[model samples]
Target: MKTLAIIDYGMGNLHSVSKAVELVAPDTRVLVTSDPAQIREADRVILPGVGAIRDCMAEILRLGVDDLVREVSADRPLLGICVGMQALMSRSEENGWVDCINLFPSEVRFFGNHLKEGDVRLKVPHMGWNEVYQTTDHPVWHNIPDGDRFYFVHSYYAEAEGNPDIAGRTHYGIDIAAAVARDNIFAVQFHPEKSHRAGLQLLKNFVQWTGA
Candidate 1:
């Protein structure tokens, strides 16, 4: 079984994520290790973080996981969740001022208070179930259909320019990036495990994915 190292950057729900992966790939060891050496040695890597983007990136740099991530993610499969997903992008609008991870050449910004006018009811930190609208076919979206609902809790969302990297999208008054992927890296702005059975299945597919 393949081993998956759930990165512990001292932020977010790392334990819950490990448990979800364990259900699908029980034989596949799910180790929560912050050591960059251990992380680089794992069969697959899951960068799970929750908090300000700046702090998460800082932890990655401070612990030297940044370099290790770059090394492993080059050819190996890597998954980022929630803030972890945002970190995979170029930058984020949350962390005090503008800051970023610069991984996929895009930036995460606040959910526009309103696209036009007369639309001021949607919550800023989009929380609860959202239906993911698919833009393209990817391994992560394997076996999943369009309009699948997933759990989400975020105030900020991701955006990309030409040559779209968006894989799954969701509507929260304003359609925003629910997931994005590029090469060996795949990220989602929601919590799969927390989303119930559908989400669990998504995690299952990820663990069994041959592409990664």
Candidate 2:
């Protein structure tokens, strides 16, 4: 059985994510912990976060999860969600420019003050379901359609430095990197736990993936 660690750096919706993982894959051992040893022992790791980037970064560094993430993400099937996805980037424009794990060569930028679709204005947080257009095929996207809608609640989105790393894209006020993958890592700006069928399918796929 696979052991999946949900890294709890005191900043994520750990219970919801853990419950979602369990519901998707009952056989897999889901460990929600902040201990580095437990994280190292797990076959797969999930980096999940919510709230401000500054506080998230502060907690991550304080708990030494920043190093743990870098270490485990090197070879395991690492999944990042929401601000967790943003933290994987080199930097984030949130909270006046915060440095991240630099796992992916990208930067997180805010949605700006004025965002609109035609004449109608869109909310800053980009809350609710939005269609994610798959850009490339991957094990995580198996059984999921190309333009499936996923739940998203983020003000900032990742902007990859290059196009190759982009796995999916979505439009709010502009086209943004909704999902990114490279090697053993796959990160999404949306919350799979809160996204219903499509989201559950993704979590199921992640559990079965071998990181090949």
Candidate 3:
């Protein structure tokens, strides 16, 4: 009867994420809430977001979920998705530069206006499926093979100050940190819910993970 909490600050794709988690791990209780008590009490926490970083940070601070996230992530299995992952960084170059939760010593930078792979130019959003190459072995990657493609729809990507915390990498025009991990915390820039089979497998691993 493990309880999982999806922090709802009103900016995430909560319904799809919750449904995906429930489908992958039928035994676990998935609670989508903004209450600090429920979030802190859950066996695992998921921080998810899909929107502008400026609005996302504003809501997170206004709702006091920032403190709750920090409290739970100290020793619990915590996963962050999309903008949720960006929010964990120290700062973001989005919307004239904004501060974030600083859970990891990193920064989120935009893909920039012009991006190309050889002579052809790539779009700014970097939308669609791309392969994620595992940089380090981790429990969350259990049963999931390397070089699997995951769904991505973001303009900004995380850049860790050092390479030690990066667990996965993907190339769009250049290498980008697709996933990051340290202790009980795991976060990814891509949306696992929208990623199909490999995505579901990752979520299953997260649910069964012992946080060791």
- 112-192 per-residue lDDT for model 2 (tens digits): 889999999988988889999998899999999999999999899987436568999998988999999999999999999
TM-score rank, highest first?
Answer: 3, 2, 1
Count of clashing pairs, candidate 3: 0
Q: Which scores higher on TM-score, 2 or 3?
A: 3
What are the lDDT scores of the predictions, listed in order?
0.80, 0.92, 0.93
Cα lDDT tens digits, model 1, 1-212, are 57889999798698799888888777898899887777878878888888777788888778777777778888788888998888777777785655556677777878766544254576667778888988888877777878989999988888633527888877766567888888888888889979878788888877776544
Model 3 segments more than 4 A misplaced: none
State the lDDT of candidate 3 residue by residue for 1-212, as single tens digits: 99999999999999999999999999999999998989988999999999999999999999988888888998889999999999998899999899999888888898889889999899989899999999889999988889999999999998743656899999998889999998889999999999999999999999988785
Estimate the lDDT of model 2.
Answer: 0.92
Model 3 TM-score is 0.98
Question: Which residue pairs clash within candidate 3?
Answer: none
**TM-score winner:** 3
| Candidates arranged by lDDT, highest first | 3, 2, 1
Question: Lowest-scoring 10 consecutive residues by lDDT in candidate 2?
Answer: 156-165
lDDT of 1 at 175: 66
